[model samples]
Target: MKLYYSRGACSLAAHIALYEAGLAFRAEPVDLKAKTLAGGADFRQVNPLGYVPVLELDGGERLTEVGVVLQYIADQKPETSLAPPAGTMPRYRLMQWLAFISSELHKTFSPLFAPHTPEDYKPVIRERLAQRLAYMNQQLAASSFLMGEQFTVADAYLFVVLNWAGVMNLDLTPYAHLQSFQKRVGARPGVQRALQAEGLLGS
Candidate 1:
C-alpha cells in the first residue's frame, strides 16, 4: 500500500494508525498547495479532489478520509488492538468519537488554516472548537483513551487534530484533562514516530 500524505496534515492520523497497526506501507509526500506529488506528478490524477491522505492499495483500490482510513488500517491487523473488535459496543462508541472529532472538532479547525480565511470569523470558529474540546475533556476524564484504557485508532485521530491547537493559539491550559490527554497521546511511540517522520517533533 502507498499512503500519499502532506506532512502534519490530517494524513498524519492515518499514517500513525498504519504504524500502530504494524502494517507495511510506503509513504508518498504530496505538495498540497501545488497539487503535485514528490515525483512532481500531477496529484489530481491520483485523487481528483487533490487531497492528501490518499491510500492506494496494491490492487488499485483507494481510500481517503482520515477517519475511514484509520479504521481500514486497524482492520488490517485487528489483533494489533488499534481498533476495538468489530460489531461490539466499544466499536460503535469509537465510531461515535471518530465522527465527533472529524466532523465537529476537525472540520471546525480547518478554516483557521486557510490562507483565504476571513479574520472576522476566527473567533466564532474558535469558540465552537472550545465547546467541542470541553466535551472531549469530559469524556477523556473517565477513560484512558476514547474507548477507555486501550489506545485505539480514535486516539490517534484525536491526537493529530488536537496538535493543531498550538497553531491556532487555542488556550487548552484551561482544560486540564484535555491538555494531559494530549501529552499522553503525544508521548506514545507510534505518535512520536509519526511526528518525527513528518519533521514536527523537535519544533
Candidate 2:
C-alpha cells in the first residue's frame, strides 16, 4: 500500500493507524497546494479532489477520506484492536465518534484556516469550536480515550484534529483533558513514528 499525504494534515491519523497496525506500506508526500506529488506528477489524477490521505492498494485500488482510510487500516489487523469488531455496538460507538469528529469538530476548523474568512466570523468559529471541545473534554474526562481505555482509531483522528489548535493559534489551555490526551497519544510509539515520518517530530 502507498499513502499519499500532506504532513500534519488529517491524513496523519491514517498514517498513525498504519504504524499501529504494523502494516507494511510506502509513504508518498503530496504538495496539496500545488496538487502535485514529490515527482511533480499531477495528484489530481489520483484523487481529483486534490486532497491528501489517498491510500493506494497493491492492486492499484485507492481509498479516500480520513475516516474510511483509518477504518480500512484497522480492519486489516484486527488483533491489534485499533478498532472494535464491525456490526457491534462498540464499533458503532467508534463510528459515532468518527462522525462527530469529522462533521462537528473538523468542519468547524475549516473557516478559521481560510484566508478569505471574514475577521468578524473568526471569533464565531472559535466560540463554536470551544463548545465542541468542551463536550469532548467531558467525554474524555470519563475515559482514558474516546472509547474508554482502548486507544481506537477515533483517538488517532481526534489527536490529529486537536493538533490544529496550535497552528490556528487557538489556545488549548481551557481543555485540560485534551492537553493531557495529546500528551498521552503523542507518547505512543506508533504515533511518534508517524510524526517523525512526516517531519512533525525530530528523529
Candidate 2 per-residue lDDT, tens place, 1-203, comes to 99999999999999999999999999999998899999999999999999979999999999999889999999999999999999999999999999999999999998987889999999999999999999999888978899999999999999999999999999999989999999999999999999999999842
Name the 10 consecutive residues with the lowest summed lDDT in model 1.
140-149
Show the colliding residue pairs in model 1. Answer: none
TM-score (all chains, Cα) for each model: 0.97, 0.98
lDDT, candidate 2, at 166 = 93
Top candidate when judged by TM-score against the true structure: 2
lDDT of 1 at 65: 85
